[model samples]
Target: MSFRSILHDMKEELGSISRKGFDVKLGHGFRSKSQRVVQDNFVVIDAFKQSCWANMPPELLRDVLMRIETSESTWPPRRNVVACAGVCRSWRETTKEIVKTPELSGKLTFPISVKQPGSRDTLIQCYIKRHRGSQTYYLFLGLSSASYDDGKFLLAAKKCRRPTCTDYIISMNPEYVSKGSSAYIGKLRSNFLGTKFTIYDTQPSNAGAKMTRSRSTRLVGSKQIAPRAPAGNYHVAHIAYELNVLGSRGPRKMQCVMDTIPASAIEPGGLAPTQTEFVNNNVDSFPSISFFRSKSIRVDNCQSEAIPIRKEGMLCLRNKAPRWHEQLQCWCLNFNGRVTVASVKNFQLVASREDGSEHESVILQFGKVGKDVFTMDYQYPISAFQAFAICLSSFDTKIACE
Candidate 1:
């Protein structure tokens, strides 16, 4: 055969092999230009697309998501539910519906911490919603005045390693006001276990600047009592504690007192006692008489037996009474303070009935609201100063004391 005819035959053979999907190598083991171009241009489009959860049937998808969203014990779901909403339109709508439910949307709960602005001053700010129907209450805890020269002072408890055994100081500013006078009002000290702590009346007497051993008031934890279901979503039953006034004489000496009356309990003819009146009545009930007592001497019908103090001076209540609120036309609990903006410690004031029913009307909750801030909600019957002081007591752990 001629050279041209041989070349033509070779070309035909190569073309036949190329059509069979075999890679043809040219000089230097490189693939043929035509074969390379054809391979580059050929795209493999998958007939089976990636599977997605969004394609799931609406009913089945909702069931699967409900398990995750409701898994959290908190009132409003926090993690997976919120994250799933951003993934798709269907997820967003489902999450919105779930969160809008009456139980979840009615209350607000948040975390809070204490911040000290100065060595003698502490500041706290938080938001609180009193009840389903009431407006949000803003709580602020700081110095009444920024001036340092004033001998009178309000302070936050300093962070203590041994909170139970050590005395927490709420010192007066300037250390010394008049000639040879020490600046100290009172100190709060807890039991060895921290289950109970007392605020002492340390203000110096007329004789001289001396620390008085007189106990102003005490708060005792109820860890030994039977646990009830939490009244609100963020709260557990463990936070229950009792407020006790120190007494001198008999079994009824120490009184379990509440400063604020529920708005429901106030009758048209009944008197609504002032916060000062309430405090004075409890304080005067103590055997020791002082000039601070008001001459009027108003009595409140809302006094309970002192929760018996243990051998260690720790008092725990067997039961708590709900306050009546005539305005809201329901039983309510007022967590507000007469002298302080918030309680010195964190506490819960639950509105429960005398019949021991499961229905809770209004829960006045005080707790950590945010970083360096605590929350107080409910009708504030007492002064902000007193409420702030009560909240200060709750900053440390009662169980661990650390």
Candidate 2:
């Protein structure tokens, strides 16, 4: 039998037992109050533990789940694995151990994977759709090339502008993008000039991480309603756009300082941090353990003090210089045909060494694929949250850079 069919049958069997096995009515009219209470409690507890699927042999359960995990390798069909996880606690734990992180499997199976590092060599292809009316952006994992095809949703962000700065509030939920919403994960905020930006994570990026004192709470309205959980904004990366002094319009130049990643991570025998699970957003709970968490750096001074181009041992990325196209009369960087119709926002990023040389492999690239639509592909040393925030910066109006 197919794996899904097997699982469905087991669920039906469990449902049947739950409906019939717990039909014993509460107290008998003849029984004393104390005796009835104890008997009723026992019946409730017993029924809770005896939902039919609990009786399945461990060996059989593992074998069935193993088959399901091995069969579905990509999304849509791959959602079967996710379905298995929700079956019960036993199924959820089993699936957790079976599914690998995006760094190893290159598959984003869980919501947490969006916060973890991607595979070193393979690009996780995704696209963004912009809604001008609502000032929101939706990120989706491209399942097919057809623009009309509904892709798997990944993340969403709503642009909020202020007199001094602009904020791109990002969330996992398409319906809610406010800081008070549990779905709020992270955001990108820019300075008055829109030349410098900071990326903030709702949870600590690593153990012993600290939040900036200035922006520890929700940022809008005269009075703030604290989140239902203990969510802190941790500064993970800083982005800066170089100003054009010649007074000529050209492709935007930018650099990103990845504070959490060490420069050595790009060299041989080096490693980058990779998160394995999502943190609990409940106020009563604490962050979950995954890999070693990186120390959080205070970014309160970033706006007042100038950030250096290259840090001592931190990873830095710069825009890949595009070659002048003689025929088209426009500068271009090859996006492997993923990008078309060039605009000033079109750019690819590569890790740069202290010597000012750039790694040939593009770590992240964003470009227009259609009107109100863009393609964002990234891999290695960065999570989808970081990448999406960086792309959002490209959408900002940079009067200085242009």
Candidate 3:
């Protein structure tokens, strides 16, 4: 059946379900006011449980959802897949299972996909727009030139400057960009000289992830009405720029230690931790993923402290050394024309072998397309969060590295 027909059928079923009569007064014998309210909630829940959509067979539902997912591959149509997930809990679980991780499909179907890694075979092209006046940066999922028209919003970060270091508060919510916001996911912090940087995720990156001493309760709303999981900054990666002793002419050398990912992940049949769900305690409140098209503003200011880096058998990445162009008299690496201008921020990252050799295939590349605009393309074994944090490190002014 066509997508329009499927949508019409779904709407009709939902409308009929909503119109089903339920006698709320049947629970009038409760002793206390709160007890009566709870009983009423149960009744409503029971009514929803009896809905035809909720009672559909798991196998049939899975097949139908899979068909919808396969047919609608791109946006306005892709929204149908998301709509299917929002039908009910059973449908949501089935849809989630059908949708592949971005590491394999290169599609951002859900919000959690941002936390997951990119595709292994193809580079997911994205771009970042920097608002200098506000010190906030927005990350989008496509290479649209006209204000994110052909693009989808992915993540946003607000730069907070301090005396000793800098912190970029990353959040899925574009409107409220802060550590306290429910959308807050991770952050990128720099050291005093801007040479050393740390990437932190609110949720654990791996199964054996250790808890840091800086854990805090995630506030729900502006009034802090409800509390959820502890939104702590778990160390995920570390980035450091080598000081340029020759000075003024050499390219910036950088290295990244992926604490959560092992060096073996780049090998065949290797695995890395993938986050299937979000950090929120209740999944019901986050049933569907929605994209916002507005600019984000800073909501809170939080201080940063030194967190010791602990690395053992972890994956290491370094800049793919650029060749000296005798004709242009400048360093150059092929960005596949994704990059237009030559800037010191332009660099490609590749995994370092155990024997100290770098891989030929570029895993991530960030380069300038225009003033305050840069293209960020990343592939598997590293998430958009990690890649964006690593790119943010390049924005820090490294006087010593220069």
Position 401, candidate 1: lDDT: 26
Going through the candidates in the order shown, the clash numbers are 44, 3, 0
Q: What is the TM-score of each candidate against the true structure?
A: 0.29, 0.85, 0.82
lDDT of 1 by residue, 1-402 (tens): 533353354456555655666554442111122232334658642211111434557896677566655554242334344445543456556655554321223211111011111111111223322221221122333222321112111333342334225344443332321111222333444454444444433321112222322212221232211122111111001122432334322111111123223333322342222211101112222233342434232111011112233212111112224454678654333443322232234445433333434223222345443334445433322222233334444554544322
lDDT tens readout by residue for model 2, 1-402: 777787688667556644664432222111111111225546534442455555567788788888898899877888788876765567667788888888888888888888988877788888999999999999998787654457888999999986667889899889988776767888888987889898888777678565753343532333333644234567778899999878774688899998788888878767877766656644333332233223343333224235567778889999999888899888988998888877888889999999988898899999998889999999988889899999999999987777
Off by over 4 Å in 2: 17-48, 214-224, 281-306
lDDT of 3: 0.77
Error of 1 at 68 (Å): 56
lDDT for each residue of candidate 3 in 317-402, tens digit (9 for 90 to 100): 89999999999999999998889989999999999887788888899999998888889999989999899999999998987898
lDDT of each: 0.32, 0.77, 0.77
TM-score: which is higher, 1 or 2? 2
Q: lDDT (0-100) at residue 192 of candidate 2?
A: 76
> Worst ten-residue run, lDDT, model 2?
28-37
Candidate 3: which stretches are off by over 4 Å?
Answer: 15-51, 143-150, 215-231, 281-310
